[model samples]
Target chain A: MNLIGLGLVGFSALLLLLFSIAKRKSPVKLRAIPALTRLYRAFGLSVEDGTRLFIALGRESLITPNAGAPLSGLGMLRHLTERTSLSDRPPIAAAGEASLALLAQDTLEAGYQAAGAGEYYQPTTGRLTGMTPFSFAAGAMPILRDESVSASVLIGHFGVEAALLADAAERENAFLVGASDDLSSQAALYASAPEALIGEELFATSAYLGATQSHTASLTVQDILRWLIILALLAGAALKLLGMI
Target chain B: MRAIAVVLAVATGLLVLIGYFIPTLAPIQSMILNWAIILSGAAALVGVFNLIWVHWGKISRREKGSLYSAILLICLIATLIFGMLLGPDDSNMRLLVNSIIVPVEATLMALLAVTLVYASIRLLRRRANLMSVVFLATALLLLIASATLPFGEIGPLNNFVRPWFQHAWALGGARGILIGVALGTLMTGLRVLFGADRPYGGK
Candidate 1:
């Protein structure tokens, strides 16, 4: 047994429980994240104006270390789908991995069902743009033109190849919000994307997009853990400096 | 149905998690992984079909990109047929991949380098915030320092500035970001394990 791994998991689970209880009494508030606020605003406008929206869920398959970013994108997609289900032209999802594409379809359907608009569900909305990273970006670039997408969120496991998609969105004059797990992609996106979520901000999509109280609780737990980890790192550095090891 | 899905998920997660801890469950873990690999391969086929279907619609409806779709379909069909007959390890299959996919992807990567430089300048123009200024300056400094002049490496830039920025500041910031990302991933996974968050069809 990896005792340290088990310990971390247990600690996190406990924090989640504590936060969940606390969440019931009062609302969980997060600091203003302009990226998300802008995205939500775009969603409202997209629906109201009957323009299309695109979400490029990047190339990483679900069963990898890079899966978390893509999964976060999926969570956001589910919520966004529900919100946009009533629109004349709902959001389109483009993914690189085949399985992720399958999951995106399922998520979209679930979202439509949740919105009580299952009849409006379109399977083509969830598309496997390409199987490879660069290919995926190339395939997804057309959504801006073909669908006349006015807003896009490039939230996924992307590499430097993400810049191409961002450039395409820019050309269309679409509101572009991007976040990725990989550092190179993040940097590239930061340069091109007007509203870029840096670092772990991408993972906060579910909570920011109003998924559930549980998501808020999870976010709170994550916030606490971040502080705890920071303290531990600083303490470790101090101890090492003192040669106390 | 949702309940069944949740039960299946929890059981699979527990089995995999516990199997990692106890050596006795290694065989079970290996078997489960094999199942996952098979499912992944099947899903890839589904993805290909989905691509074909979408493109087919484009062609049938005489959409704007119908000609591109036709070309893509033709190429895809030819490649698949050749790949099946020659097999993946065959010289012809290698030739096919090396001839087409490699050069295109490599060209895109080369294009990326130029785009990144342009993007940095564009960043400053688009957003003149503190972060943007810092980002552009650092990128410019790194570019200059990393390059070899007619004489040699820039003394302070290469020996002190670049090294300090790369080794200390960048490394520290990257590690901090990584820690946060890891924590988020762990929490998200745990949320699913606890059945508090169902990202599957159940949600």
Candidate 2:
């Protein structure tokens, strides 16, 4: 990795770990969930009322480490399924890959059974929309435009071009909880609406939203290491500038 | 099998974590990178297979979208043959594919930019709010700054704005976003490692 790139990655990881730990200790909830949850609460109207959550899983993202793995996003999918019991409506898990679709379907199915809500789950809702990003986005637009989606949680490996999907949801007045580990995605998130989840935060969604113990602990470690990296980088940069090396 | 998948996955995860600390471990790094490439390549095949299966099923069932299926299949098979058999090394074949494909893909993608501009216009007509105004203004500025040709006397402007935009957008704005991106990745990896999030048929 280039010096600055490595520095950014190293520092950011440290910061997140630190922040995650401190946040864990606090009883006071940001409720905003780093920004997007508040948007959801405002647009979605009801927290307890049955509302559909749509997750767009990107297939192409798996190729790039910077974008995180598609399977990692599937972990979030599993978490969503597990947490669906707490919500009134089961999330409509959309996948760009059939394998991911099957994984999501099985996970959600198992989760429903685990949550004792097996009867409420529908196989049709959790489906493989298409094999391509544009096709998948086309298939998903109808759900945003036609269906009553209380909150759309797009925590997966999506690309920059799919930003319009989030914009479509916003225009339709749907609460969008979008997350992707792609750099361009973060830029899109910042531009379209700041409610976007950046790199590691996309992975943390299951932990953040579900409030699971392991997720919480892992997030803490991540933040601590991230801060440590940042401090080291700043010092190194300063030393280099002063010709201390 | 499930237990094995879990064990392998956990081992892979731990190796990756440890490998991060031991920067000199090129083999570990390569293994992780290779795994990523293999898994992703496998997933792409899954996409192609599904596409073919779905199209074939549509044709058999005489579905309403069967015609679209025919077009899709023709494109898919043609592209596959062109790519695999002839290979992109053949300039003539590459030109043939690019001549048709590039324009089509570009046109479709161009629709998005059009839609964005159109939507912004509609929003401005409706809202005229501060945030909306800022959004429209920044987009316009970016578009104009990017697309306009700075010839002759305007060379200085281009030189000045290009570096400024590069640093501000690429370095500054990008840094904050990268932080969030790193956090999301670390969390997802952690989740999978802890078995709190099982992705690969793990129990």
Candidate 3:
């Protein structure tokens, strides 16, 4: 048995439970992420202006190691859908994978239902853009162009093909906010996107989107675990420097 | 229904997770995974139908871009028919894929190279800060260093600067980001297993 792995899981679950309880007493004050804040504002502006917001959930399978980013994208979709439910043009979620498209559809439905705007929901609001990475980017370009999209969010798995979507958004003069798990995509977006969240910041979508205290609890557990990992790495490096085993 | 779904998800997740430490439960995990794969395949079909339905609405309603929708639907039907008739391994199928999909993707890649160059220039025009200049210079150096000139390769850059910047600096930052992403993924996964956050339509 991998005892260390089991230990880490147990520790994380314990921290999660503890924080979930603590959250009811007082709200957790999270460090602000400016890019995410701007993304929220842009979506709000799209609603106010009677323009659509397009969320491009990249073509990553739910079963893959890269599923986290796209799942996070879905979480954000739910929140955004609720926020934009009463708008003339509801937000559109375009995903690359078939299963993800289905989930996106479900999330949108749930969001609208929660907001008491279920009658305004349309299945077409959640789209399956394409099956492949480049094709997905190609398929999504038209939606960004033709849908009266005032703003777009690319918060999924993308590689160099992100440049194409960015270019499309650029041409359309839409506000672009992108975040991805892949470094290549992140770097490209850093150059093109006005607001781009790098690395693990992609996972902060739900916490920043007015999600439940459970989301905040998870963020706290993640922060604590991050510090622990950093300390372990530092200790290991120091031991190596001292010629210790 | 929500409670049942959450219980099933948590139970299945626990079983699969426990299967890791208990060899006896491995088969149960495998069986559940097989079911998941089948569900995903079925979901893909639903997705294709959704695509067709959306485009059909656009075409029927004569939306502004309905022409594109018609073309897409025609192409999609043709591809599906050809693939179904001859199967994926047939030479004609290979020809169809190679002739259409491959070239389209390659063209996209070519466009991406141009787009990156354009974006780099625009980055300079927009940001123009100290970090932006350094970013632009570093990207240029790396691109030039990796290329072969008329005379020969840039030996000093390929040998020294490129390696140092990539391995010493970029790699460190990348590793740090990766560790953070890993932690975040773990937390997200745990949230689902714990039913803290449900992306499957649960409120």
Leading candidate by lDDT? 3
lDDT of 3 by residue, B1-203 (tens): 88999899889888887777677898998898889899999988999999999999999999888999999999999989988999999999999899989999999999888998889999978667898898899999998999988889888998999999999999998999988888878888888888876788977
On the 0 to 100 scale, the lDDT of residue A168 in model 3 is 94
Per-candidate total of colliding backbone pairs:
0, 28, 0
| Alpha-carbon shift of residue A30 in model 3 (angstroms) | 1.9
Fnat, one value per model: 0.62, 0.33, 0.75
Question: Can you list each candidate's DockQ?
Answer: 0.71, 0.31, 0.76
Better of 1 and 2 by lDDT: 1
Candidate 3 residue B110 C-alpha distance from true site, Å = 0.5
Alpha carbon lDDT of each predicted model: 0.87, 0.64, 0.88
How do all the candidates rank in terms of DockQ, highest first?
A: 3, 1, 2
* Stretches of candidate 3 exceeding 4 Å from the true structure: none
Per-residue C-alpha lDDT of model 2 across residues A1-245, encoded as one tens digit per residue? 55555565455445545555576567533234555456435434533677766777765443356435466566666655656545655577777766677666667776666667778766655666666666677656666665567667666666665667777787777767666666666555545543666556665555555565556665666666667768987999899999998
Candidate 1 local lDDT, A148-207, one digit each (tens): 799999998999999988888888999999999899888899998888998889889988
